[model samples]
Target chain A: MQFIEDANKQALEIMQTAQPTLVGMGIAKDVVPGMHKKLVMHAGPPITWDKMSGPLRGAVIGGLIYEGLAQTPEEAETLAASGEIEFDPCHHHNAVGPMAGVVTASMPVFIIENKTQGNFAYCTQNEGLGQVLRFGAYGPEVVEHLKWMEKTLYPILKEALEIHGPIDLKNLIAQSVQMGDEVHNRNKATTSLFIREMASSIVKTNSSREDQVKVFDFLNSNDHFALNLSMPAAKATMDPVGKVKHSTVVYTMCGNGTEFGVRVAALGDRWFTAPAEIIDGLYFPGYSMDDANPDIGDSCITETMGIGGFSMATAPAIVQF
Target chain B: MQFIEDANKQALEIMQTAQPTLVGMGIAKDVVPGMHKKLVMHAGPPITWDKMSGPLRGAVIGGLIYEGLAQTPEEAETLAASGEIEFDPCHHHNAVGPMAGVVTASMPVFIIENKTQGNFAYCTQNEGLGQVLRFGAYGPEVVEHLKWMEKTLYPILKEALEIHGPIDLKNLIAQSVQMGDEVHNRNKATTSLFIREMASSIVKTNSSREDQVKVFDFLNSNDHFALNLSMPAAKATMDPVGKVKHSTVVYTMCGNGTEFGVRVAALGDRWFTAPAEIIDGLYFPGYSMDDANPDIGDSCITETMGIGGFSMATAPAIVQF
Candidate 1:
């Protein structure tokens, strides 16, 4: 079947079926408080060594460690083959993933709820590194770090956010746009801006300066963490408009860590899925696309919300600093 | 007493010092309708005609054409020497120009307002094509296009923005963070996200289909427009915070078409200015950093908001995308 539509037809169809509404929006409500919220963090697809690329393997191994299913890469492999450990696509949870997307449940997830309509969305916290479990890097250090983030960081942030009240993601998004941030690939300004606002509150809530430092370091280390908050924000925005009857608006574009899927706003949450393609991007040293895996993760919510590749033109210096 | 501090110290000191905050960052807002927002755009330093670099010269010629100050390269030279046109630093107007940083009164500027404080800041709009205007090319097509953006594009956008209500920049920043955008060099996601929001309104307001289409084309064509928006947002946020006495918050760091300048929160709007140095970056064909001018423009608002180089970790694809 021909999947591509002519620009004119596409535009007409889009205009007819889709009212240019916001979709798949959510906020990192985890940083804010008591606003009743419901979020959905999808599961990743299952894949074995044969199906995995190098980075994918690495990410998987990292997941095993993060989940505490294995202590080492060797053990991770053995555990996977024995089926002693679970393997599932993030999509199982209605989420998307990037290269080697892998998220264990314990990982903190953002919960976004729409204020206008009572809809919501969810996504895991950012892993804070290029090569991560969500990215398919199974290693001891990776596991330990994930454990720490979940055990220490996520809870702290969740609690702090609760006390902080509802963080208005719309505000952050607007501010980010003005700060030279595209919100998908360049979130430094957003994250920093967020931290600036919440740092004092977070510090006031935490008894442990060490934890505060850790949180700050982690936040400072990962410029995309605020994105964790914003995804839910986008998710919240998208959910209200997602229920339009017979609408062509995209509701969700999730990756189950195996295939990429979409749910039309008019079609409810049922997804139209396509096998995920490997993302072509620069790799870390000693790695290449050959080492990349099928795109996985809930991050594509950015695109559903009208960001990501759709806006690449805004950032021509993308390939370089 | 010398008010100027060291670069790094000034960064900290501006935020630390007590001073009045500047408002309305970005040129688009400050520009009077029908009056091209004019700021003198300058470069790192002066260069001899014989030493003129390709991209730098090309940018100047583009600037000339954009300003309609010259009919041709030969004519542009005459105009430049005739003293019929003004050559001043963008900083003088409380604005910035990036790259070659050449600003003519005819060039469009972003106007940003601090909602709470009512401070204003301005910066010229992005030229779209690489190695143009800011890179120091003076020519006719450039001038005509600038005129078009001023006469046609800017007014429509201003009205649409007004109708849309004030864009909540903070909200975009937060959402963009989750989308993997850092609000700096990689603003693709942020850029597209904003366009998606504003497109419908812009279409509704445009009188003729052709006019609407032209504006759409311009918005879609210019990737850097979102960057313009982001810069102003950062300026707005940082401006208020910088007003805090001895807060040590860096409010502004920008190049005035010819020089790099910084304004500490403590220092208020006092510019600690210096000659802009050439940047080290990948350039287009037949151009290198050697062919480039000193980095100019209020684009540094990204840095002020903590993206650009600050959050390089988020986009590991830097220098590799």
Candidate 2:
């Protein structure tokens, strides 16, 4: 009982005092420590190429192409078959992602720091929707958008941040929760707030008005722009509370397309696994449950941090969806 | 009954469609459309100099010094005694303020436009706490802060805004309501969100790092910076809903320190007034209820807009107060 009380105290301290901030934007390899060539970060827990689902496999192929190691899906498939590309869980690298959560070396990642604890976490930028790398479709359009985000969006945000400095994201997330964002799945308020805060910086930092316009249009058009930042922000805050010796609290909740996995604090990094469930929700036009993938991605970090599914009552907007 | 339903319909349309945007910032004269020398804008419904409260009188005298029309409080008092400065309600000029809401010609005002209705509203920037003009303190320090806001803070925001472009404030306000801000006295979320949104533009547009630091420090330090903007945003949204024929719905609620006033939609700007109530709440250190002024300013616009005190149940943080 005493141990339980002490663990609760430690968890409370992390939850109450952790200050997560949006420090900057960077590519995975440069920002993520110890990221080596041919290494890929996927969603959920550790899984091999053979155990990978269709979408996960597709994402791995997409990641290979994104990293310029493969030009064609067929070549990428050959490499995956040969076990040349090393696949790893994003959590292993102190990173997380959505869907297949394939993060390659060159992919742009949101850098979130837990200022209170002096630790950091990373997540790849959300690719909006439809035929994107996270969802496993890597068409030419996906490739183009990724390249544009790297070349155009990255530099503008980088320069703007240089002028603006770091943003206290935990404060924002808490406020956003009050404003109608569950901080997972429903992020309309946070995204708009993000746009409002960064719009001017993006404009003044960019020498060209066209770039500013493009950046503004892109950010506003995508409601999920803050999701990437929110994910890592959650991780940065929760990381401190994790790994307690006898804490019964769940630290990490995620999926690798094929299975749902969670890391219990008492069990250290040992993952408790379950079979993945089919996502039961409204789908896009012309798409049905048949086309839907299993619940995948590291997004359950929100739930782990106590706001997503765990606090659905507070965010009825997302619950309705 | 039919007329009442129609008025409600109109009110709903305004509340639903009114898209207020923070278009720009400028001097009261430049932004308020009509201007003449010696005119002053105060909070709430109209009142003569003889009927004004102690704080109202002090703010008026401060305005004189701020405008360089008078050098001392005694001289400003004489000018007021002589009726040389014409005082009018800020609402009459399509503007609003909190407390002793005095707006001189040279005072900097946030310019908000209802993009949907194609109308504008204005409010002076919050002077922050302490010996400030809004609370009726016209000391040299107060005068100095107002001048610095005009000379430094105003221009930096202006340039950053020019680079950033118009902000959809209506969306932000709605989101703020969801986030725990009643959009009246508790605007912490909106203010932080505003800071996050504007920090970068402020950084990039300003040539001096020190100036950028000052602007950031000033804005970040003052949680009420967005309060002024929020009032005008509310007014802009509610204005079109106002003045409907034969409707009992309240359109504007405000106070002039001495009296509380409400404008019904059917009244068409005809204010229904009552003796002001003494503010009963937690006071600053060394101050008691007797030292506090009557409930004042155009802040009750939030209640008229259906948040503020009306929806305190949704914002428990404020309800606790």
Candidate 3:
């Protein structure tokens, strides 16, 4: 009991003091070390194409299409099955993604620094709901949006940041929580705060007013702008605390569509894994629970940080929704 | 008693729902209606040159110098004595200022709109701390900083804002209060949040990187950047509530160096004035409490809005400071 109490103290201290800052945005191959051609980072623990869940496999096909590695989904599927591409979990590269969480070398990623611990984490830009690459429904629109983000939004944001400097995500998160956001499933407040913070810098960049409006309009229209940011921030915040020995506290939690996995502080990098439970929520139109994949993505990072599902009590309104 | 209760309820409702948004920044002549070339605005109720305090007189001199109406403090004093420079309280012009709170033509000012009420308010940029225009010391250095703010900082912020859009100060104030700021004498958190929100946009503007750094460095070093904004926000918040008739609740309070004044809701803009009491706080080195100026500035707006001194119980740590 004493050991558990001491461990809980250290875990709580890390949760309390974690300071995540949004430092920059850049290409995966350029910013993320060890990222190279033919290397793909996906959500959850390592899994092969044979064992990959349907949504995960769909996301990989979409990634291939986005990277222009294949002319069609069938070709991409064939190449993926041939095992010619190297696949690793996003966690291994200090990166995270939602749903299928497929990350290719060319994708843009947010750079989050754990200022308190001097470590870093990364997450791809949120594709924004319905038919996004993360959820495995990669179509022409997904590819176009991803390309647009890469070509226009990413560089403008980079220049704007060069002018402004890093943003302290911990401070933003605290403000968001107070404004009624758990920051995982419901990021309305954080997203608005992010837009408010970035709007000024985005306007000052070399981008045209039309382009700036496009960015702002997209951000204003979507309430998930901070979802990717929160994931990386949570991961960075929990990293150092996870290293405390003899601590029984949970440090990391995730799902890969096929398995639910958690990293316990005492066990170091070892993952405790189990079959992912069937998702039991209402689905979109033309979709049913039968079509649902098991729990997936790196979003559990929010839960690990004591937000998301863990903070449901503070957000009865969202629970009602 | 019932009338007072109704007025208090109205004030509370306004305080709870006031939405002050920073819509623009511009020259006073262009932004503030009826702000002509020769008119000057000061803090608190109207007072003649003979009745003004030393610091107030000194600040008026500084304003004259900054406006190029006079070349020297002696020349500025002569102009005031001649009664050629018309002096009106800032409150009359939908503006507020701290201490001497002097404003002259050509100085840049923030344009804040109360979106809920469709009314507006104005305030000049902060001159920072020590030996500044608002505090009554208008040295060459004071004039220099004021000119720089007008020429450089103001335009960049203006352009940046044009690109981004208006910022809601009511939202910012709510967040600041939660983060340990009464936003009157202690605006540490509000200042940091403002810099964070503006840094990126300030960077994107036409200003050179070096100039941007100068602006950022100045803002980073000073914690009073939000003081000017807070004053205008408070005024805007209380404006609607102050319109309630036959109510005895105080709507606004301020002091020039020579007279303290209150405006009751039932009395409209008519000021009830008394001799301004000398401040009794500990003095700086080489100065006794006797050297302290009478309670001055339009900062009483914060207290009127139920913050600052009125919210002291919410912040014990600041009381210790």
Better of 1 and 2 by TM-score: 2
lDDT-superior candidate, 1 or 3: 3
Query: Candidate 3 at B126: error in angstroms?
Result: 3.8
lDDT for B138 in candidate 3 is 81
True-structure RMSD, every candidate: 19.4, 4.5, 5.5
Per-model interface RMSD values are 19.1, 6.0, 7.0
Tens-place lDDT per residue, model 1, B1-321, is 234334445444433332222222223323523224322345433333334445545555566655555567777666555555555544444444555656665555667665555555555666676424554555555666677777777666766666555666656655554445666666655655565555434544544445655675555555465666666566555665655555456667775334567766666666676777788887667989866666655667778767666765655333211
Rank list by lDDT: 3, 2, 1
RMSD of 2: 4.5
Report every candidate's CA lDDT: 0.56, 0.81, 0.82
A1-321 in candidate 2: lDDT tens per residue? 999879978887887788889888888889898677799899999998898898999989888887788899998888887877788899888898988999889888888889999989998777776678888887778888888888888888888877678989987777677766787887766776676566546655745655655676666556677888888988887777776778878889999999999887778889889988898877768998898777799998988888876655666365122
The 10-residue segment of model 2 chain A with minimum total lDDT is A312-321
Superposed model 1: Cα runs more than 4 Å off: A1-321, B1-39, B43-65, B82-84, B238-250, B256-276, B285-292, B316-321
